[model samples]
Target: MTSTRSVAACVLSTGMAALLWATGLASPASAVQAVIVVGTPSATCANPQHPTIQDGVDAADAGDTIRVCPGTYNEAVNVTKSLVFRGAQAGVDARSGRTNPARESVVQPPGASTGFTVASGVSNVTIDGFTIQDSEADGINTLSAGSGFTISNNIVTGNRIGINFRSPGTTSTDSRIRRNRIVDNNNSLPAGGSGVFLGGGQGTDNLSITQNRFGGHVNADVNTQGVLGGGDPAEALTIASNTSVDSATFLVLINANNPRVQSNRISKGPAEPSGSAMLVDANTDGAQILGNQITGGQGTGIRVAALFGPDPSTNMRVTRNTIRSRTDGVLVEALDSGTFSSNIVENSTANGIQVDPAVAPVTPLLFSSNISRFNAVWDARDQTSGGGTAGTANTWRGNVCPKDSPDGICR
Candidate 1:
């Protein structure tokens, strides 16, 4: 897919300079330009007589902000310029029904339908401090290929998808998805929707999913589910340091290659119900699963599998994470080569590490320096690796049993 320049990308270049200017740290222009505010029927707007969020965005160059007021604005906001769209106060619902025009008439046109539509490939655009809900497709849909954008400090609920990065074929990289409280985005689909979805088929790379609370159920079909999307296989992605609770299927499904899922706290359906915490399926390789604590899911904590029959995983690392519950801690199968080291697997009803023989004809699947103690089942089961020889090739060195490990209290 040939990448296109998104409005978000264009603005991000100038947004950094604007940030510097806003901080009073640098003087890009001769004189400091006063902060501009937009939106109508208010005395505080830059042009109290004539102000619209779109107008402010249109007036802004690269480094600028379009301050949106508090209220229900039933309008689709599109940004072609690079800028920050900030709310003066929190709980600004931009879904439907304008605020009482007499007291606080929120901006709602005669037939405004959607909440926010960020197109024109504007990069580095930060939409903050609002309660955006009940949009047509997504509350905030960034279809443009832009980087360095932060959709933070907002309460996005009752929508199809909280934040949708529809940038498919753009070189939109280095974006941050953080600090947003996303919940109940199960409006459109019956099985519920993802709290946040990053990247479409247009090739997004170097994205970060950090420090956000993603809740609500996502149904699994042949495709589509989980917090992050089945991203473009060509890009390098990162899903780290986030909390995923009560998700139906995989917390984060990675069809993309070279993605890292680290340090995230994930809890899913109860053990009796059976839900896979993370499912890495189909043509994925070079992934790193490190330092994540996953619990209560029915299936494996981390499942790495090929969508096809013949291909194999290579040069991957699953290290130093904590997995608890009835699920297997680290399940490695069908990989040509990889390392599973220093992970603490406990309380699992199944084997600590399940290396499936169904995938690859057993060679050595490295299992070293791991702590598999207190698990309700065997520390390590060689059933799936190979009958006997295929199991021994796995180096089970420096593994402390439940009775002897530092945390010596076995279940």
Candidate 2:
């Protein structure tokens, strides 16, 4: 067995330098240092660390701790010190996001980009529990600039761009890209595989992407997002409890500033013309789409668009979601205002909750206790007198549409 993991990494390299001096990454004058085992012998550490986890991160020092262990590892790392590269017992039960699969820790890296380059003055780094599969590009990359990063519990699959916090023109603050799994990333086009592509060039601050699990890919917008925000706004962004299946176009695509998409779990697999599964296109001054459970989509399951213009999306809150869609399951057109409550729109091919027909002094859309059934037509639609947004004024109370065709709009 590869010489019993190289004699269990030379007897765990003398007990990993006394467990790296009781997990403090030992540096108190090296406290009798002597590690660097690499493949088998349970990997190992110490002696400024090595045995390839990038040569113990080029001989770790800045608060060292390069554990690694189990097996596979092809090489493509760059990470510039400031360490904490685990994998040995990974996650240790941090919600069992993996690890202990025979001491896991893979990192394939066959041709090129191959994972881990975390550039630009690498700050407070911490990449835990590895798997990071077939990557031709992006699997934990930060092109330029860095900040306190804590990318946790990993698995990240076939990549093209699975976690690319593209720090193009600077700005990458307090990061915490949490609990990961990220499936079939960018299966090569359909927005080219983005399961977390914070593209906002000069953006991001206090970012916290929670419990992740983005979908499998073969094309459902081809994993266009599981979290693909970045066009500047993000100031204390927090996308909660993530989970997606077929993922098409979005499972959270932000233009943050008061962003907080809570209790996530968007179903939808076997791809399709899947477009919406939450796309807060231009959140300005207001945001919060709570308690999610959106179903399949072709258009809206939560698409509040304004196309990133003069802060178009003003005052928002689409609550208690359960949305299912073919089109409008909550499609608040061109912003201007928001407030839809206790939602539960089912089988909609059209309008389950749509307040479109823009242009006007329109800023008072408040539909309450929502509940639209088998929608085919108007379970709730305020196309504001349809004639080109004439003085749009929508205010429906206690909604429950599709009873009498178009009688007083789902009362």
Candidate 3:
């Protein structure tokens, strides 16, 4: 298995040419990029140029590198240039029961401000390896319309929102957020904050958020909303291989286009009854929810519904997910033209897999190769116009379950 740091390095290298082009630099060979050092002088970062991180950033060129030494920087760092900001132990996760206080770089911003602010129109910036906490706002806030940012290997906690991409329009494109520990950002719970919030915009395109550990968020671990004033949909947004625990909601995708959510471990939803482990709704089309391990709390394990509007979810492919819940395992409402296959749902207090009849049409939906059992009510229940598998408009085949509503649907 490849390490996350190696993978991030490879991904960063792939975008090097684009970064050079975006900065209007001739080439890596031609550009005279300098390296500025911050904090006290050391063996690795000798002859420190700037005493503070913001001073180093302000003095550097667009493509320069800023190396910060191990120290606590109690100030907000505003990044307006496309530079690489590397801290001590950059691209390394030191939260695996290792306490290296002498080798850690920490940033704690005061008042209602962010720790790191990647200003609007600044692209190709890399922020790696820092413990950013105790901010009234986000730990890292990327303003609208920036692209090609690589944020990795940081521990962001005790903020309102850990990492926020506040795109209003002309969305941020081709950014990567990976290998970070984003936890306990529930300080602004009354205002509904999240670990990572992708705000409303033209919707962020080609944004890859993967391999992060998230916990104790008030709203959700990962939350995305589509175009605010209605423009293009968010395309190719991938959320994969994340472990999210003890959040109000694990993942929530609203109106995303063809999003791929794969190989995530989601556990312990909020204590509230309305919380869900995963929710893909609000006319989100072509969503692929695959190969996830989910353990629910008081709410459903997986829910697909247009709770905010009347538009139904369409063309969703939910496959090979294992879910165990205190409430319903899977509850789908206001969906159309989807396939639910090869799922293992069990030990639910309510129905294992239920398609609600009260909402919009769930027709042309295929339920096949599923194993649902040990639910308190019916294992599989589709309360559509038809009574059973033979009469319903939806197709059901090769489902192994103990009990089903309107019978003859389970084999």
Candidate 4:
């Protein structure tokens, strides 16, 4: 009753050079170092990367360590080198997005995106504790200059794109896509969608997207379009503590730079249909919005748009976020400079900050200590910085809204 490929070819012809001399990937005059095994572990590791777990990471090397066991293996794994795959339980990396009705071990069809594809000059890799499911595009795809990596405690699900760090030709730098969990990834087709898409081909810089848990049952769009137009200049990004629900377009920063979106937790699920939840479009520049918390979106939670496509620049520093639902919690249109502070607008049907059309007198916009409440309509609206007039110059300092009457507008 030995079969599990005959006890992995009898432990790859006797401990494969003592497990490649205890995991250094063997250099002892090379015996063609080959030993691929999976499941039913008799405990072993050495030149392993392909007894099927995506062909032992295409025949591993570069300090290999592909040691898996505990059943369920369906394919799609492509780490180029500098490996360290280990998933025998954390989610059972065979794409388990759940599907019963006799689909027992359901090979593929939950979010469908496959897994692992860290190509381009691969660097120190390390994918741990698996549960990647139905990936037709992105379970993990950090292409181009694969730098020091470490995707942890995996559980990525049904995909169009989950973890994508691109830079195929020129610039790809310091990486550390962290603590994984990304679920029901943007699976609405259209090139797979986007759960964590960071395009390549433009010097991708020091990225450190942390503590992941993007969108519950995400129908489409979690985090993509964060600079994927040109080449070189999408620097120092650091999105933290993630969590989104029913995201159709949670975060989109075209032509991005110096970002730091923090403490995320977008909402919209209970069977979503309302779109646009956080779209900082246009040639977005130097950002630093903090303490994010957007909630119950039917549409438009926080939208700051401009640039239309061909490279433009500005400066931003939005602070202390907390926007609420029903639509338009924050929509500061077009830009030149920014510095909103201590934000916390609630119950918006529209207009919390709907200031569009500005390109004159250089009055770029600068509000302070914002805090509008229970909005049913205009708390602050400017079709064009007061020419179209809903609120002009927009100072409204040290704000608050008991329903507005101390000139903070809105009644």
Number of the predicted model whose TM-score against the real structure is largest: 3
TM-score of each: 0.73, 0.37, 0.88, 0.38
- What digit string (tens of lDDT, one per residue) describes model 4 on residues 1-411? 211221223234557878877899866453233324444333333333244665565555566566665445666666677777766543333223423322121123223445677766787787777666676766777766666677766767676676776643234446665566676665656566566777654545667767766664443444536455644556777777777667665677666676778888777853576666766655667788788888876777777765446444457777889888657787775666667778888888866666665533244466677887777877665554442123465455666655542244332
Between candidates 3 and 4, name the one with more favorable TM-score. 3
> Model 2, range 1-411, lDDT digits (tens) per residue?
011111223334778889988898876543223233355553243222244688767765575666777777888888886677777545742334464455577887766465787767777788887877777776777646677778788877788767776432225457787777777776456444666776535555577778877776543311212223345555666778877777665544445567677888877743454677776665454787888887875777887765644456667888898877657788766676778888898887877777666623246667777888887877776666432222336666667776423356556
lDDT of each: 0.61, 0.66, 0.81, 0.62
Residue range 1-411, candidate 1, lDDT tens digits: 111222322234588878878899874434222245555554544443125566666566666655666555666667776677777543343223323333232333222244566666667777776667765366677756666677766767677766777444335546776666676677777534767665454545667767777665464211222223233453557777777677665354445578787888877767333556776655556778888888776778877776543456566788988888746776766666677888888888777766655655335566677877666666665444333233443445566655421122122
* Pairs of residues clashing in candidate 3: none
Best by lDDT: 3
Question: Could you tell me how far off, in angstroms, the CA of residue 294 lies in candidate 1 after the best superposition?
Answer: 1.2
Error of 1 at 309 (Å): 8.0
In candidate 1, position 256 carries an lDDT of 56
lDDT agreement of model 3 with the native: 0.81
Task: Order the candidates by TM-score, highest first.
Answer: 3, 1, 4, 2
